[model samples]
Target: MKEQNNTTLMTTTENYEDYKDTTFDYEHYEELCVKHDIRRFAEVFLPVFYSVAFILGVAGNSLVVAIYAYYKKMRTKTDVYLLNLAVADLLLLFTLPFWAVDASIGWKLGNAMCKITAALYTINFSSGMQFLACISLDRFFAVTKASSQQNFKKRCWAICIFVWTTSLMLSITDLYFSEVKEHNGKHACLPIYPKDSVKEVTALIQILEIVFCFVIPFLIMLFCYTAMAKVLLKTPNIKRSRSLKVLLTVVGVFLITQFPYNVTKLWRALDIIYGLITRCETSRTIDLMMQVTGSMALFHCCLNPLLYAYMGTTFKTYITKTVKRFSSWRKQRTESVEEYTMYSESHVEETSSFSI
Candidate 1:
């Protein structure tokens, strides 16, 4: 019996070793995962991460859109760009429920849904980040040259169209690389590429995203913000208005919310390449760390709307009014319920006394 068990174990190990080279060898993955307890990690944390992401994401983006749509005066050129950002964020949030359900309930949603959801996810991520880059460049030019603002405003619509179109193309790339497959008696959408090519493609795309959408734009934003800060500081002769403070806060929040995510992404790309080439023994640990760090970037979808509230004056006012109205309604509902309960109790007491 012991000899037979040993033979079974050896056969399984040999099969797993051969299977790793295949694209959809989720069975092998599952074996390695069981040996290392990967599902335990997912079960413990994925639900919480996605729930927080969805709730905050939906609320924040909705509020931003509400404020922007409500106040016509808030539609400056900059605000229009922010409106686009808000729209992208909202679109992304709209898909979070699907992801949340998938994480909790398993992939009951079908191949069509898998592809559509994947497309939406990629499109939003690419479009949203690219829009951020465009906004950063616009700011850089506006600050660096007086005439550039006029040119930027004129070209803004064209730039937006380009960003969205490019994003749409990039997002649809998933349709080519990924497929729906059954695993562990459940369906999953996974990227199917040669082992080496899969790693290469992942690294290539991450590098492209970090370089074009993150590092370059961040540097531009850094320069603009630093220069702006210097001008604000040195110009002691000039009085800074509340509006100037507000504008600085807006730019500052953008840097704060986005910078860490970009830095982490760049580092993650390097880590992936390093792990692959060097066959680093620490690859597992690095991958785990990337998962945590990537969540920080994922949370940005939730943070974008908050930035609009902080930066846009009209949004602040509108949110305040909305919150007050909600509070008033809650109070009235509570009072009405209490009053009904008291009257019901008195009627019951009187009936009992009359019967006595």
Candidate 2:
């Protein structure tokens, strides 16, 4: 009787799989479930979101680069770290158009583009997070060693180079895991592992992402920021200015933006293990949730520039002065030109009167 029941269950499962494949019944429902609601509400909304992210991210990051490049006064030891961060953010934001197009047109861009988009996005995400961790480490060392602190300024450039090079090197994993495939008449970026190694590969990658990208980074950031805060608070009779407040605000932003994502990521990693054991379909929902959270996570690229504006005292002061001086200089130049023209006209009139 038990054997007969097991056979009946196997037959039912096979029939369900056949139904899912041949009948278009549940395909549309699954597609709808996976499609981002913001993308579905208006065809143009995804494009608009991507455009705004690109504009703000590029402009903000470019401003960071320019401030460090053109404004000699803004070039500090810390600016070196920020310069690298801006570069990463800019690259990450640039990839948004690819994602936007995929979401907007429902992945009509084909396989090559899908791979390229995934590669760029993963590279930037990993690299940017790593760089942020580097920044926290820099701060920790700078603060802890205070008087005996080695001059990090001279070494910062080398550190920046290493950060970017390592990022590019590690980001190739995306190509291995992602593939563009036709699903429900739309191309989708699916995580396709080696058939035999799928379970192990998914588990390994998810664990690595959580550990390297989130858990370690968050702990480092928390430690450095906490230590920094304690030190600042202990400095006797030191009145905190608006600038100091801005600096603290920058720390707050990092914690708030990254903490939730990290928590969710860790939970998802554990869920993958559970799925591996139970053979459940939970990975699908996790992937969808990750997409939405990941989109929100991308906002960090935009927010970092704002943090730079508020926290980088040299950048803030120099940029404002430069703008004001340029405005004044332009006004003075216009007045001088007008005066010269008027004088020239008067001289010509006087010469005509004398001739007459």
Model number with the top TM-score:
2
Clashing pairs in 1: none
- Candidate 2 runs further than 4 Å off: 1-48, 73-76, 147-154, 241-248, 276-288, 325-356
lDDT of each: 0.57, 0.59
Model 1 Cα lDDT, one tens digit per residue, 1-356: 10111111221111223234444453544444431333335434556776788788888877777767764444335666777787887777676666545544456677677677767777776677766666555554555456434455557777778878887777665656555655433344544445656556766766776665556666665666666556556555445454357447656665665566566556655644553312222434443444454456567767766654455566677778878888999888777666665678576664454311
Residue range with the least summed lDDT across 10 consecutive positions in model 1: 1-10
Give TM-scores for every candidate, taking all chains together and pairing residue i with residue i.
0.71, 0.72
Against the correct fold, how does model 1 do in TM-score? 0.71
CA RMSD (A), model 1: 9.0
Q: Give the TM-score of candidate 2.
A: 0.72
Off by over 4 Å in 1: 1-35, 137-154, 183-186, 194-199, 237-281, 324-356
Please state the error at residue 105 of candidate 2 in Å: 0.7
lDDT of 2 by residue, 1-356 (tens): 10011111111111112224332344443443443432243236546766787888898788778777777443445567777788888887887776666554556666676566667776677677777787777766676665342565667777877767766665566666666755434555655566565545655766676666667777777788678667666666445455347547766776666666655566655543442312223434444344445545677788887875545566788678778887999888777666665678576664454311
